[model samples]
Target: MQFSIYSKPSRKKAWLLSALAIALLGSCGKAPVQNQKPATEVKKAAEKPAPAQAEAQTGKVVVYQLFTRLFGNSNNTNQPWGTIEQNGVGKFNDINEAALKGIKELGASYVWYTGILHHAVIRDYSAYGISHDDPDVVKGRAGSPYAVKDYYSVNPDLAVDPAKRLEEFQALINRTHAQGLKVIIDIVPNHVARHYQSLHKPEGIEDFGANDDTSVEYKRDNNFYYVVGQPFQVPKPQNGYQPLGGEAHPLSDGKFEETPAKWTGNGSRLAQPDFNDWYETVKVNYGVKPDGSYDFDSLPADYATKSVQQHAAFWQGKDVPNSWLKFRDITFYWLDKGVDGFRFDMAEMVPVEFWSFLNSSIKTKNPNAFLLAEVYNPALYRDYIRLGKMDYLYDKVEMYDSLKLVMQGTGSTDAIASVQQGMADIEHHMLHFLENHDEQRIAAPEFAGDANKAKPAMVVSALISSSPTMLYFGQEVGESGTLDSGFGDPSRTTIFDYAGVPAHQNWLNDGKFDGGKLTEEQKQLREFYVKLMTLSATEAVFNGAYQELHTVNKTTQGYTDKTYAFTRFNDTTKVIVASNFASTATSFALTLPADLLQQWQLSGGDVELKDMLSERKASLKVTGDTASVQIDLAPLESVVLKF
Candidate 1:
């Protein structure tokens, strides 16, 4: 909380100005009508087949994510703690209650909590990144929820009773189910803690492959950041003995290293020092670890052939406690807790086998559970696992690559074409987004840095890609996702911001949505997020199959910018999701297949129509071949047509 970090910008004045401005842009696009039956209204609708018929006819599916724990324990509040100014503002504190309530209201089919269990940590590395000492964050909270200390227990601070956390978690699940939302907790099965009671080994403990019994202290080796460590390794540890270290069961088919020396340690977290003392554990050969620890730790493995064993997440790989599950349990508990699914954290570092296994497991609980990948380039999926599993992954490289080629004023259409070609060539298992947790927010992604144009660009990719779509909070309304890269700032994701309303400020006051720190911009952006999330939860266009209509060129790059327009339609419903990312208004058109036009013009079952966010009816004129309409969108805006 220093005056030095960011020259604290004046928020109050801007707050007053934007509140007034929403009215000018008060385009309350009519939300899709609710065929959704609350528990009370279900009886009458149960006999009526509206919802069921539509579902059966189209085979629709939707994903609703909570983005935090308390969706693990979030609460639903009635008011803001104080006035919008000088008071309890846009923060979510009580996650449990709010999550239960938000699910049904938002209509999320699946609810996901990012981190909810007893998140792990290194003596100090977990909280301090590579530093050996703890960093001064809010109350010295050392690690992100990604770091796991204990797998079985939930975070004590999150619940009223530190001891009965799991019980309370179950209660949260029941409450969520009452609201018709499914829970999905986080699961980290690859690595364990540095000095947990289960895996501590003293300095003199006999080496058993990777110091299986040593207190996890691999700071000297990079491969052990989250791998396991030697107990005496930490300057301060609760136990006199070192913690046991863990590693992936070498699942690769390559030549074995025969010793831990070749495997320095895990460097992905970049949170710890390197280790050269791993004496226990064999890295699989099916895939090579990023650092070449053993092999196949990254590739898809044949679980049936290999004997399975590994710890949970390791904050630091070297000299770290040998108990990381890698990418299994922590996220799994979210699913266990009734969260719908997760936007996988650093998916690339995790082996492809884990995802395949978990995705299948989730089906038993809730087949509709949605899993979106944060992989660098979904196009990389061209290297499909002979038996890999996952619903969708983000295509990071291609998004930036295409943005540079197209919007930056230098690339040819072929440049953009190849990117789409990769999309076309790959299987239909992907989720595309302009931004998510790790990168900078859309309003200020290094490429465009144009707050006004970010939303349109992000939406362009989200709507057109064959993968299921998503809107990271704060993408719309031009809010940035900039993080304090110098220090450990709890993740806000490179995801787009969709919240930009007054309700979030009010919700923050009610004391459930606060995440400790937020600015006025955060509050405004949360409103847009709520609307965007609501749209995703409620619309049919986004949930079903989609195809790009036209506009290979002519869309601008500023406000009123029009990019590719697409349509998500079924026999009974036809929704046009048209977008323009440039500042000047542009017109785009689409022609429906004959089957669609015949059904529409004849049956006129195009009974209902609405825009996703604005909640307004769409304007249109239908002739013989197609229904013609000129959509007017502000730069960085989209129109979701629902029928």
Candidate 2:
């Protein structure tokens, strides 16, 4: 979701918005037929699914974060800078039962469907009563999914019937549940698309910035910040750029008209934002004072110890902020449609107190609702987890970064212990993942340059702690992410443009949802992933106690900086995990500490330990107060030994 973190924007390009298409770009150089639903039928719920009952059956979550716009795309015409006409987009209908079954076979319990919200795109939906978005503000022929245009409607590009998009999405949700998979969608509360118009808002709800008092720069009740006596002007294209690759349109004149310009999404007050800024959207206000003070009441000191009902009652009669109510209503609307959870985008940008109100209300309604937040600050991790009532936060800076360093052969295996020990108190709240939409692909040249290198990292990320694990759509199939996607480079998939993923398309196998076209190496890599995921989901020891053997074996004979070891066990099962991050094969005697031996009640003799990843058994030679196993590991290999 970030545009080159290391690259800073110059003053000239800071105000320029990357111009895209003014009309919708359908795949295959042909306009898709738009089906219309009858006006009499409306999307309504039949009955609520009991989440508590479902949670009892579903132990831990293994999320497959599928980019909805690109997941089912089968097009292979990967012409660089190609329009959507050349590279077709995936629709909701493409997520058929076979697709869900394929994902389920990968041992996924939940599907995080990204980009389901109705965002501002350069599509000409004028025939369906929807206006076209200006290419001057849109990111690509498609649009940035984070720049939400409507809070109540589903993206029309994802449905067969444009008018019945919400119903089609509901059917998708139902189908996902039929395969025993829960659905999670993104909720961007920090900002909305610049042309924020909710065409399908409920009867009583009003659109954002509609009733704002535009005379002043800041108001407690206002939804947006305005530049007094100023008019909005589009920034001039930079770096030899032109809208839609020089495609001309009447509205692409770089002359957007806005009297009393509003603040940009990144809090820039400039009348025209540079291309590097989040200019396509506008920031939302939550009653914060101009001097960085709170304008509304703060939470009481003892709010953490209160019940959900008590927290809900605390704000019953109080005059809360308007923005808070709008967000709460939006969440309620999604929950009514059977969305099992939400992944809040840039959640740390907003105040944590609002999350207290919003998340508490959500948990009150469904106690098992998954609330995952994108928070990167280490200092605020505890506050967001305990006070904000979030279920999980991304462990990116610590575990993911450290593992990436190990994958690149630049870091010591000893660092994994510190990352685990530091988060010991709140480890369950830290969600682990090697690849997401924002990070680089594992097989990309900028990363490890190989997907097999992710095995050890995936082992620790999934089984080291009792937290949830996530995998992006193509991570399992070794997607190199080296495509010259229009707006996005090769290291990451294009979220802003329309394109097909190469490796993922191979697995799509012409909509068969089977790995019919995969090579031998790719098929083996996928099988390794399937085994890892299945073990993580079905193992009893995954939820048990954790102990680090890496610290003890760092100085042991045959153990080097490229190796790591750990153990997890409860009363019934004891599992030992060992990994080698080196490029060459090595043999080592994995010696267990005396404390671990006593914990597992092992005496000096021979014990059988089974390797879960390779399904090979080995005998552990036990001495007086310790146990040791002779292991031969392949390059970048990891093993899970169970007794």
Highest TM-score model number: 2
The parts of candidate 2 lying over 4 Å away from their true place are: 4-59, 305-307
In candidate 2, list every pair of residues with a backbone clash: 13-274, 13-275, 14-273, 14-274, 15-273, 15-274, 16-274, 16-275
Give the alpha carbon lDDT tens digit for every residue of 284-379 in model 1: 111223333332133223432331122112111212111222123334434444455555553544445444444554554456665665445342
Candidate 1 C-alpha error for residue 186, in Å: 2.9
Global lDDT for candidate 2? Answer: 0.80
| Model 2 C-alpha RMSD to native | 8.3
Please count the clashing residue pairs in each candidate, in the order shown: 210, 8
lDDT measured at residue 69 in model 1 versus the true structure, 0 to 100: 26
